[model samples]
Target: MDSSAGHTPEPGSPDEPVVVLGVVAAPGQAIGLARKLVEADLTDHIQTTFPGARWQLELLEAGVVQPPAGDAEIVDATRDLLLEHEWDLVLCLTDLPLHVGKRPVVAHANAVHGVAVLSVPALGATGVRQRARGIITGLVGQLLGADADDLREHQKSPARSALRHRVRQLGTDVDEAGTAFTARVLTGNLRLLTGMVRANRPWRLALGLSRALTGAIAAGVFALVTADIWLLADTFGGIRLTGVALGSIIAITATLIIGADLWERGSSRQTREQVALFNIVTVITVVLGVAAFYAALFVLSAIGALCLVVPQVFGATLDHPAGFTDYLEVAWLTCSLATVGGALGAGLETDEAVRDAAYTQHPAEPI
Candidate 1:
């Protein structure tokens, strides 16, 4: 692929000593972060720490290439990017959750090659743009020949703590492969999980399931008009209603996972652990998607019940005075029933469609 085929290059002076930094990022969140890096003008920030040379950013979106699995592979890919572009240094950002041994890797830098690979998900779900900017600045500073201590001292107060705490540099051997930075153990895993889910963007799953939403709305509307449903809603206790809600959500979540074959099955030990991590991320993504659907159904159901069902008629049927709680109960029951209908409707969707909607990117491994 041509290095400068699509993206516009950041403007800079050719006469000045310019350091062109090429940013190759995986599609989705990683690409967005890369764009933000350009908009933020990290070159200006880098100048504050390293000083002297003008810096320019060149971005390449790498959606077609599969994410590199290991540090060596990542370095190789960065080197390839460097060869393709006239970049003084390269940074490859991927949404993939990278692991070095048992720990989650945040980023890796090779001074000799003038390249770095950053795992975006390891930065977690919140304040991603800020964290990315900070980390990138530090890594770019390092690539520009600024020592860690000098970079640390020059970094803004806000980003200093983040650089110190979030990134722990490892591997002392001064080889071409360079040093690895990893997140702390317990908090790192938590961040990885949340970050993976954020990358998946569970809300999109609801938007993708058009057939399911139709079925859910149909069921919810039918339940709203049914006298039996109204009576049951009035009589069922809060605990019973809660149980029903939980059951329906679980049923739908499981249905999508099973029906679409989203569950990962791996053979080797390392692969198994990776599979488990993917599975957990999948489950959480589905659950959140289902829950969002349920919430929408409940809101619509409640409105329908309030507008369609007369208060006096509902009171007469239940043999008690109708109140706001009655409307809520009706909505709650309708949501539960609608969810089950949605699960049934989910069967109409193709496995590929579900998989595409549910994942940020397809893994190189089989799902």
Candidate 2:
């Protein structure tokens, strides 16, 4: 299949006023956003925002294109695409988190080269499509040489003003990308972390841990029928149960990271930051996946306890009258024990499988 298939420009004479805009996007979230851009018919928005030339938008998938280490490399890649295609301007979208020194880069534009690179993860986790459209529109305007007066005139419109506010300009001394935009400092890092986790799609992690999930279900079912487990659940207080739950989750999350060697190590300052960022995202992804697994186990255990365990026998085992809360307690305890078992079962999985489940694959590296 043609990776670049979508939104072909209309055949026109040489004197036509249409300006071709090529969107080259990394796979996963970035590519999906590119499709959304096309479906949203951003040409009308761009034409309205710029108000001069008719815009023709085309999407190109960056299949197997690894994330470059720096913004300069990103620009170089985009520039190559610009030279190879008929695009008057090229916008490269990547799920990879990009940075300029300590700041998280939202977008970068090189007016001279008529190219721009937007970091999808830097847009945060919520309102991504809307935010991306706004940023992309702004970048297009900048790349097309919209002057300050032109920008001021456009900002008079509420839509253009909002797009302008989404990304605040940052200094470009770090590289020759010409112009760069970053989110606010503290909030930006939090958003980037969340965005990275979202890109990883942690819910899929639950499905990927097939072996561990099987082990968990087995343990939970076994615990459900055991009288001793019932007694322990009844004896344990709420605080103790909560502790057990938290401990089990942490243990499993840590085990997966350690057993899979998902933790990244780096030597240089910048590399260390990148490494830390990747590790944090990895931890969060695994934690969320494990939490989901725990929740499922709890629900299943709750149902099993209610149906399989005789209320009279449970009460006799606990030396008290069993109620709904008692069944819930049993489910809670069972889930924690099952999660511990799942942690052990995770050891059965190959490192590569766990890594694949836990991380999002990028062209240059896995994050």
Residues 1-367, candidate 2: write the lDDT tens digits: 0011233223253432455788999888889888987888577777666543345788899842454455555665675676566456788898776654356668866543456778887778899888888888767765543445546755687344422322111100111111121122223346445555765668778687888888888888888899999988888899999999999999889889999876755443212223344566677789998988889889988998899999888888888899999999999999999999899889888876686577532222100
TM-score per candidate:
0.52, 0.52
Clashing pairs in 2: 66-363, 66-364, 67-364
Model 1 earns a TM-score of: 0.52
Q: In candidate 1, list every pair of residues with a backbone clash.
A: none
Please report how far candidate 2 places residue 126 from its true position, in Å.
38
Best by lDDT: 2
Each model's lDDT comes to 0.66, 0.67
- lDDT for model 1, please: 0.66
